[model samples]
Target: MSHSIAHQARPGHKRSEDGVLRKLRPLFWNQEGRLRAGYRVIVFFLLWGYGPALVHGVVDRILSLVMAPGGQWSFGIWLDPVRLAVVVGAGWLTAHYIDRRPFSDYGFQFNRDWWLDLVFGMVLGAALMTAIFLVEWAAGWVAVDSVFYSNESSVPFGQALMAPMVLFIVVAVAEELLTRGNHIVNFAEGLHSWGHLPAVFAAWLLSSVIFGLLHIYNPHTTWVSTANLVLTGFFFGLGFVLTGQLALPIGLHFSWNLVQGNVFGFPVSGKVFYATSLVRLEQRGPELWTGGPFGPEAGLLGILAIMVGMLFTAGWVRWRYGDLSVGRVRLSHCENRLQGR
Candidate 1:
């Protein structure tokens, strides 16, 4: 009698543990071992939103007290690195804990394969951005100039190289961690199977569009510039989908900006406008072709170039990573399992 009672109690204890596991499921489990939206939102707010603002306040006050009589602090270079580290680490760690995801899922690994993909993607992305510049020149929309900035001072070749590297880490790793890693996976997991793709695209659009809009305050932004940004977002999102890995898109993004803003001395996605850029332009032609005050990115040629790039990269990713089919590809299946869990 006693033995039978003990056996029955053991089964009951197991049931309680199972129940606990089920409740904790959402915390640890994600679709395809990726982070979810809840995790991303919390981290983004903590790092990008609040963290930077708070740090800025501190730095501003410190500068006010310590600056030379007429010297004003330029927070551009100083604040950027701080924000980059905080935002990237916060997003990564938050997803790891809250969504119960692995860091590799966010493309933190720097394996040979990843480096190869990065190099390829970077080259490809730069070519596309450059093609737009060429079209603008051919159409007589702009006259070429060697200097992108009025200032003769070089930005220290070392600084130019290092800046883009940091920017790449923030843009690629941080953005991937927040959007594709957590937000996309979460939506895919939460929604019905049939709704997964739509959900993913919707999230992609929202995230990408927001990214462009945020740059509105950069330097010279206009309606055309903003539109081009939307296309860029689409391009970036497509890369994320096609590769099923974040590193490729990051590489592409870094290269695009490096070439546009640093190498060519052109506006990056129509944001930063310097006078003496490596690729200089004097707009003597049409606004549509030249991108007007918005930079080259505003032109029709710019949009076309981006679309071409998107299609080419998409094909490459498909060739390398396999077709984007449910279960056939791991990322496609991630959202499904996350929803189930």
Candidate 2:
């Protein structure tokens, strides 16, 4: 009735009311021709992360009762994948419909180079970890302990490799979706509304710190380890910000964990895992140098290794793309680049 009376007052009054509504409408959608990128970027994770996790929990309870352990019921072990997928899916939907952006804009596309990039990233990640291990061994910071759980699994050694790889693959994908996919890209663009390059740098710093915080609850947490994680996060973020494709970063994350725990039998950031044929490491030197129970990434050697990885990645991006800038790319652009290989 109030609306009707106000409308009846004058045709000129209706125009004024619409102007007010237009101003309010932007709270949900960016109608002012601004991206309001941050609002959209985190909205899905903030609002809907728990709902899916709750539903997944309930489903797992039912599955536990209905199926045999480590059979079809074993799917519960993969819950992280599902939990992270909910956020990724929500972001995808938002990007597709609300943002009206190509999927590639989010730094994803399955092309010829996709497999190569993934494999290369995996190798590079493993190599970096190996380098850290070798350096520590050479320096006598760590000693080669007895072989840990050497091929004692029901699955053969070759197949056992897949177990950790698969787990880390899910972890890598979920993290990429959370940080590089949602945080860095969205924050960069949103900050760009204020200034261009500075905005991107700010986003990089902010996301890297946030990424470090996310791991704070892990076992054997320390100031040194935490700081290393922050730096490592930045290192990973550089791969994406420079290449604008998450393939390298995703692979790096996956293999780093796989080799850290599954292959090398070190505490992966204070968390340990079991798998087939890999020698265990025992830190013998100063805790600060070896990271002690916290893992290599927390140690001085790990920090050195991470910085070197950053340099290598920067060099690779420079060689590949002439210059590294977070320029948006179309799906066709991604495909065209892959065609040569």
Candidate 3:
């Protein structure tokens, strides 16, 4: 595969006349004159791994000088933005230089169609979460304790509610960019020679596995939770695979976390949000059914929700576009440039 790709005549790539340059080109570059996919992936991971630690170290040192000893900042409020910056910066750099493509090619075009799909995704996510809460309630598995409760007396009510909202929004964008926007696009592009449908499916499945593994170390994580998260990744990627836009996935992700942790007071992926919740509740159902401390994503109900989400996403795509086919996720850089994208 590598040998074939090295020799293929890619559009816009002029073969070097110099013997040394020609010989070296195949080693470091593809037929398109861009860094090969494997090398690009290596550079991306390196930036993602080290950039956060370096930035955090410098920020921590600077904060230590001004703040009192042992004084702390909210993890969600403070550190999340730093992570967002690092992740977005890494993705932009990789797309612009290593991939030799427009950053928006990764399904982030801010057009009317994108925004409409985003709204649909957000509504679907909220509706699904509400269904989960209602189902548990009907089964007598959950008991509500209060509404608009805050665990911290020092924090104002509005601030408590707003913090998690901001956190989830930032989290949604960053995670979707890394997991769906960057990983899937690159994977599909790298595998384009395998054929479009095969490349898209393979890339989707591979990136979803990575997404599940990413949450393996979260608080109270279990095998069941991890497996369910793999399904969740597929659910989130459905819209992207169909429409090739990040808006749907991002909106769905944000609303799902916000409504799960803040609105209904569920432990989101095992991390309990103790600060504030609109409807505090206790679970009395069996752990297997209710997900216990790991939230719904660890339970059967979550799997059901994921299936429903996939169906709804497909329906939306069919309705909006009058066709239900995979988007051009496997379009290569040369192809994109020729189309003037």
- Compare the candidates by TM-score and give the number of the best one: 3
- Cα lDDT computed for each candidate against the true fold: 0.63, 0.72, 0.82
Cα deviation of 215, candidate 2, in Å: 1.2
Evaluated against the true structure, the overall lDDT of model 3 is: 0.82
Candidate 1 lDDT over residue span 141-239, tens digit each: 667665534342545444444545555455665655565555554544445454656656666677677667766775667766887877777777676
Best by lDDT: 3
RMSD, each candidate, Å? 7.5, 5.6, 7.7
After superposition, the stretches of candidate 2 with alpha carbons farther than 4 Å from their true spots are 1-35, 69-87, 148-160, 274-277, 328-341
| Residue 19 accuracy (lDDT) in model 1 | 99
- Give lDDT tens digits, candidate 2, residues 152-188: 4454566555556666776788677667766776676
What are the TM-scores, per candidate, against the unseen true structure? 0.73, 0.81, 0.85
lDDT of 3 by residue, 1-341 (tens): 98778678553255334656778789888778888766776788788768877987887676667776434434456666786799789889999888878889888888899999999999999999999999999999999989888876666777778778877887788778877887887777777677667777888898898889989999999899999998899899888988888989999999999889999999999897655888999899888888888999998888888899899999999999888777645467574454443
Clashing pairs in 3: none
The better-scoring model by TM-score among 1 and 3 is 3
